[model samples]
Target: MENFIIYMAKASGLIAVFYLAYHILLKKETFFNSNRWFLLAGLFTAAALPLLVYTKTIWVDPVPMAETATRTVTLEQLIAYKQYQQQMAEKAAIEAAAISINWFDVIVGMYLTGVLLFSIRFVLDFLSIRRILSGNIVMKDGRFRLIDSEKARSPFSFFNYIVYNSAQLKQEELAGIIIHEKVHSSQKHSIDMMIGQLFCIVFWFNPLVWMYKRSISQNLEFIADAGAIQVMEDKQAYQKTLLKITVQPDCINLTNNFYQSLIKKRIVMLNKQQSKKLNSWKYAAVLPLLAVFMLLFQVETVAQEKQPAIELIKLPEAKVKFAVQIDKNTQDSELEESKQLLKDEYNADVKYENVTRNPEKEITAIKVTVKDKGQSQVYEVAGHQPIAPFTIEIEKNNSGRNVITFGNSIGKDNFVRAQAFRIDANGDLQDLANDSMHVQKHKIIIGSYGMDGDKMPLRSSVPLKVPEGHWSVNSLKIGDTDMLIVINGVKQKKGDAIKLPLGQEIAELNMVKAKEAKKKYG
Candidate 1:
């Protein structure tokens, strides 16, 4: 919805620019036919220009990663960490619902309401014209069907039908009006009026759109006036005939009416001399205006190369075995469960050794030993200790890409360290790179290349640098979850920690509760 509003705003601005050019450069010219076509073309250009997009590519060096401290934790602590995160998420959701008004929803509702009202008005205007044409035909000819109606205060033409009140005009005045109406019918000026009306209905909120509609209506009249004088014997008499007709309230907006409010301008236009053939150069000015509009609103996508792909080699799998020494603290049920889990999940064998107990018959000590491909490791624990279950698996996803996972699991909670690979035709694994996976660095350019060149950079894909001595979120974490950090008013995403300024560059640092943060940011 936000994107749609932005598109409409850009389109409206284009229409305004096109209309301004016409008013200054082409409106006064005697080229009525040219003016008519130009106005129609302007509407089409405005509607289509913003949709045209160009893509470009640029290459830069990848940014280096900043070093940070890391830590290892037991399985029990990982489970507690996940539970804390779930609680925080539920709390944030509750606070988000507390917001009284969503401005986006309000704006969308208002826009839809306006569209509904204008749509109804458009339908009524069409029905009003249809009613006037019914049961009112007085004469039928090969070219037109003439409707004589008391409701029609002035002469008007709608497609092949001409409507007028014969009782309101003299014989001589009627002849001139018919000639003008006939030109409108022959040229199909009603089609232009209908198009203009539709634009007005859809863009009712834009004042520029209304102005554009007026320009179209006025140009159509001028074309009809020009066509009429060419066929009539006396040009002066036609101008006087235009003055004789009293301006009445506008008829249905769908029709081309003879009595327009611009009668004075019509008289002046009729007396004006023809413009020089060379003055047609003014139309060329539209090319530059169109170029400017494209440069300002058109979207451009650019990509740049920074580094080459890294080759990877697959190694043979290794056999793993585990040895455990049970104490009173190690329940028989837990030991059985852990042994079954290692077998099912990792294809590993587990064996129990000597058991020990204290004077109270409670678990006093436990020991574990691991052997993988002939390499062995041992660890001893006294009292309660967490033993994390580990796994290594190779699988293919829905896209047929190979996924390798090395992780520790506790029920539904998985601490994963994984990578995706694509098998080439030679049956060798290759890294899968995409927009989310950066193999190189790039800068995106979105404006016109000829006008703005590479000066207008929307953003850089390169990592930002943090000043020395700055306190950054690179090392900040909430258990296995990354901490949500905000600097100045901008919330920082993962990997944005390196972009922070130095401690002295920062004037203040503050933190808020999860609920407060959710309410303000959401």
Candidate 2:
């Protein structure tokens, strides 16, 4: 997560700086400097949106729990259980996935790669242009190196040079034309293009990127106009030259002859603002821009505050024995009844056997056979394992009687165990009727840092009724973490690097509902 944040900050900061640099260094004298306001808008919008929606608490683990009731229900989902879930009519529940997505990774990867590629192209293009322009240089007018017009009235480009139809221009107009194109080179407008390309990629789906590209080019044209025309004191001389070459200016000479970049607009701006002069010291705007941008750099926490912890949590006994059978014929009874049977049968039979000495260990051979007659099925979930708290669904097979398998079914004193619950009914593995069971106020710790994890203090009562057998976790903010719809439960200390995009749909839906309600009632 920290890496992700750093990547985003770097990309954003660089884009802002490049935009500013173009305004201050290369095009300060032209209309380019005047358009810094637009870049400033982009800077504000991109930096603020993510921060505003981010939560205050970012450290604690996610907690997923339903807040229906703390009292036990009348149904018996399992023994030692006061109540079970009551059936609820079928409806769509908000997804409570607590995982986060680091879109920053995508941004960083693309930006860096694009920059490298652009640099390579710039060098190659520069080389080709230099080779062509070397033999064609006729004279230097202000910033432009006027070249010989032998080929045709073509506006061809190679690297920085826009080799123009100099034969069509008068001697005076040629100076102005060379100076204008040269301004483009000296200002490193091509470099700006490379940078703009990255922005184009980040906001690839945004139509605004294309519009902005046109805008930057137009601004550059205006800048070159102002700078080139400034060399001559007589406005009439520059205006005559400008109009003379206006018929067909230089272009990249590609299949698309449409320079919708608005050269006409560039000329008009140059005329209207001809008298205005720029003070180079205006570059001081950089300080405040940097100052404001610094405010946007954030730490990679889910949120940035502390939250309360759970009040009473019931944990299983540290060392409980489990008998797993690979035979797949074990009775699928609930945990309570099975627990009673185990209590009676294995009470005296609970003897630890060392694998080395006991070759004929009957305990290892004992299996809990489960029978399934369904047509099709996929068992994605293996019993929960390390790092990843739960097993991801294996595949999307909706049909079949699938057997839930486990590797570490048995437990010992060293390895702690709990009284596990199993889904007994065949109708649906999930508890759709959520009110079936009720548990007292017991909270699970989540998104923790160490073995002695960071606990979110629980102020509000988060009692549970089994919803779909997985417990209700969505819509509830987990502790202080920026997680929305995180599960409320004890968590193993891992997977802290997850980021902000997880479960965003549920959070947004909640916000949307709140907005609709406000509009309707108010």
Candidate 3:
């Protein structure tokens, strides 16, 4: 809806520009036929120019970073993170529900209402012309239909039908009026009037559109007057005939009325001398004006270049070991279970610092030391252990193989959760869960599964709060893999999803396996 409004605005601006140009350069010229076509061309160009957009891409040097580190999180830390996210989501939902009105929706409704009213007006005008033509045809021929009716106050032409009150005009006056109406019928000036009416209906709010329609009507009248004068013997008699017919109060909007309010201008144009052939060059000015508008509104510039890949640094070889020392009173089974728990859950060796005993002699609290390359960092735990901050450094070992090291942060704000993955030589993700050399294929799906109340879920990188029946995809990984993103059934190019700006909520989202995607999309 917003996009449509913007397009209308651009089109309206173009219409205004074209009309202003026409009024200044060619409106006074004795080029009625040329002016008629030029006005019609302006309407067409205004409607089409905004849609012809050109995208331009530019490349530039990437910013350099001194160092970069990935993050490795434990299962407990992941669970804690999810809980925190859920709390934040609930708080946001409460705040959103407190709001009462949406101003955007109100504005859209008002605009549509205006459009409806104007459309009805257009239809009424058409019907009015239709009713006047019915049962009033006095003569019918291949060239035109002649309608004699008391309902028509002044001489007017709509398409092939020319309407006039035969009893009110002298035979000589009728002859001149018929000639003018015939020109309108032959040239199909009513088609131009109807087109202008439609433009006015759609853009009823724009004063420029109303003026544009007037300009079209006036030029068409000028053309009809010129055509009438060429056939008549005395031009002054035709001018006098135009002056004799007073402008009617019941003039139909969709027809060419003989006695228009611009009667004085019509008389002036009738006496005006022929324009020079070279004055036709004024029409060429529209080309440059159109070019200027295209540059200002239709061109889109984008930066297409990406940052260079980071180079991995080499680190010294370090042997890591885990040992859980127990007292003579501790059972061998309990000791072995503790060692396995550290290996399976923590995925790292830890040194026990301060172990507190409960009333039953069981450990209640413990301060654990995690070591990386002989550098030890201690973290105290009570009942529930919060996520320990750590960073994973990517480097090469002595054998020139890629190595991933997990340890406490070496600098402030250096730690981040494991979100980055590197593609190996065989186009597989390196399995950080196991050895750095191990690679596997992974599938990741990110989308919303349901709506939040009446509101639809938005596709975003961050997590959002949804009701009980809904679930949004924050991030999901099955095996180790690259993702194929399809929005509204269209498969996007690599990195396009990240660059695309989403302004609307996601309506529906689905994920298909590689085999299914290939078969369905191909």
Candidate 4:
């Protein structure tokens, strides 16, 4: 839900930027076709920008530790280090306990409500238009349907259907009306208007979206008017015809109304001289503006600092110990027999005890009590014993309650092993073994092998969190052995290639060097 809000916000920002550019740069130009396409392209590009956020890495050189002469540390320095460690631990504990709430839920709820209302309104408006067209007098031609109506207040067209009161106008007035509505029909201006309605429904809260819809509607009128005036014998008569319709305008949301607002501007445009062809070059500005948007908002950079490699050491096998208890009332021979039985059955180092402290409680023949091994693994680092992943902990109470826990590294040997590689910007898994698939500049096929997320192997890859790099593919081929892969460099066992979202998530490809392979395996 949070991600959805973020995407909507980005889309809104894009629409605002592109529309501002169109209004300031190309709005006054007389190229109606170019203007129409420009508005449409802007709307689509705005919605797509958020999803194209390609993540790139910014690599920095590893900083070296300062060289110092070897000397014994003073007692004061040791105390200071301990104090610093304590402060950091307390700060981490405090941060972990804090909780935060996001208010974006309210914003998303309001946005969805607006979209629902506008969507319903759009559907109803279309249904109303359909109802009006169902029972009218209809005359069909090759590409248009003419409706003869005495009730229509003004002339208008919806798709190929022209609606007007034909009984009241002279033959010339009727001819002008047909030519005007024909332009709307042939150009399919209704499609553009419908696109505007969809944009408004999604971004109803944005005032600029409303303005964009109006611009699209108005441009259709301009184009239709320009085409209709060219064929009319008396251009002044067309102007007069527009005035008649304006006096009693027919207002419908889904149709191209004849008496749209800005009557005076439409008249002025009709009389105005043709604009120079060179002025049409303003449309070229949209390309660079789109490029600027991509640079500023579409690409993201993440820092990937290199770290020292890890060396895993195998420790000794762990020893488990437990205690066996016999009842205090048991005979000496019975106690001895119970202890020997427990020691043989468990194969563990077990000690026997006769309990007299709790006289009221009686033990069975032989009761073995296993101690908690949850905290058994601890490594001494810089004179401090920090708990390791293999650690376990067990707690036992006087009330006979026992709590046992397994630490994170309890299942160290149960990990899936595979060869992994980094996915790059071209939405591909970099294949160093095959040079054609290694570099992003090379074209990668969109078949099952490519990392486009279209189709993937059933269980090939696992995605890693950020800063750890993106993907881990299992068991890529190196000569013949299947190996366990870690960070796209280390290999132990064989598995399938992991599928990932490529460009958006993965960053680099780290294949094993031939020299390293020879040294490790040969």
lDDT of every predicted structure (CA atoms)? 0.61, 0.39, 0.63, 0.58
Q: Name the candidate that leads on TM-score.
A: 1
Candidate achieving higher lDDT, 1 or 4:
1
Across residues 1-522, which tens digit of lDDT does each residue of candidate 4 receive? 888877888888878876887788766767878888988988998888788977889984232221111111222223344467689999999988877554677777788899899999999988877777888879998889999876676778899999887787878888988899899989999888888889999989989999988888888888999999888788989999777655636466778877788887788777777677888777776677667877887789997866523222221121121222222344445445433433343332223333222233333322223332232222211211222222222323345444333233312112222223444554344432222233123222211233332332212123322112344333222233322344433333443333321111222223433344355446
Pairs of residues clashing in candidate 3 = 441-480, 442-480, 442-481
TM-scores for all predictions:
0.62, 0.38, 0.62, 0.55
* Residue-level lDDT tens digits of model 3 in 1-522: 788889999999999888998999999999989898899999988888889999988974333211111222333343444467689999999988897787779878887898899888878887888888887756986779999998888889988899989888888889999999999999999999998988887788899999999999999889999999889997887888888855645677788988888789988898899999999999998788788888888999997645433333221122222223333233334534554445453354545555665555655555555554545556564653333333333333456433434444333211221223333444333322222211111122222122112211222122222212212121233332345555544554544322222112232223333454455556
- Expressed as tens digits, the lDDT of each residue in 309-333 for candidate 2 is 3232233111112232112122224
Instruction: Provide the clashing-pair count of each candidate structure.
Output: 7, 46, 3, 19
Better of 3 and 4 by TM-score: 3
Which RMSD values do the candidates have, in order? Answer: 16.4, 19.0, 17.5, 19.4
Which 10 consecutive positions of candidate 2 have the poorest summed lDDT?
Answer: 387-396
Q: Candidate 2 vs candidate 3: which has greater lDDT? A: 3
What's the best-to-worst order under TM-score? 1, 3, 4, 2
The segments of candidate 3 whose C-alpha lies over 4 angstroms from its true place after superposition are: 62-80, 306-522
Q: Give candidate 3's TM-score.
A: 0.62
